[model samples]
Target: MNTLYPVMLEPQEPSGYCVQFVDIPGAITEGETLEECLFNAAEALTGVIESYIELGQEIPRPSENIKEAYYIAPDARVQSALLIRWARGDRSLADIARALETSWPSAQRLENPHHSPTLKQLERAASVLGKKLVLSLE
Candidate 1:
């Protein structure tokens, strides 16, 4: 199934930006500029989807009842990544919320894959997760 989720971009100091999957926790991409960040985001999303499919897990479907939401064409590659993450037993929603200094509900929304999270929130989440946020020129 194809799912559309909002990506939130935030500007950083020195000249760079970051991207995050609004609905998926710990899914983030960064770039030196807005355009680059978006490009990278698309790639990351693809990878996540692919990973999920490979694991033979049920990929989450976006709510059909909602309108005005953009769906990222469902890609097996991106789904696979998400599946793997789910299997690995990574940070929980409450854990992430406390780490990011946000509330449980807000963090839950970030995991919805339908909500958009701000860039600043992404950066902070990355830090908490011990993931490196990178911005490339290419």
Candidate 2:
């Protein structure tokens, strides 16, 4: 099953943006663009879920009051940051591909937000990134 949660997008000082989970405290992410910020927020949420699961903890569900302060299209900065973190963390695209049982190029496509990754693929990518996928209604 797929879970979609409500996330709040807030603009930050200087440049870039940040995301906040309505139900999860300290669960935040930022990026140079709205797309990147949102995507990173998703990934960050996944990671938080994974950590909870690993520790046999409970996951936080989204609240009914979820709302977005702003709206923007996808951006490349999010993909780049995700890729950079994956690389810096010594996480290989090939490894993620293998974990998701996909081809390297396919995995590469996922790293590119512009490629339009499916929810399942994103879930797998999150798993490979040591995260869990969750979606909740707003």
lDDT of each: 0.56, 0.59
Superposed model 2: Cα runs more than 4 Å off: 69-138
The prediction achieving the highest TM-score against the true structure is 2
Poorest 10 consecutive residues of model 2 by lDDT? 71-80
Error of 1 at 86 (Å): 18
How many backbone overlaps does candidate 2 show? 6
In order of appearance, the predictions have TM-scores of 0.43, 0.47
List runs of model 1 lying over 4 Å from the truth. 63-138
Query: For candidate 1, lDDT tens digit of each residue in 1-138?
Result: 224556667778877877776565445778997668767877776666555545545555444543433234334323323422353256687887787788988766544443455656655655676764443222
Best by lDDT: 2
TM-score of 2: 0.47
lDDT for each residue of candidate 2 in 1-138, tens digit (9 for 90 to 100): 223456777778898877877766656888998778777876776666545534535455445544543322223333332432344256676877788788988877764433556677666677767666564433
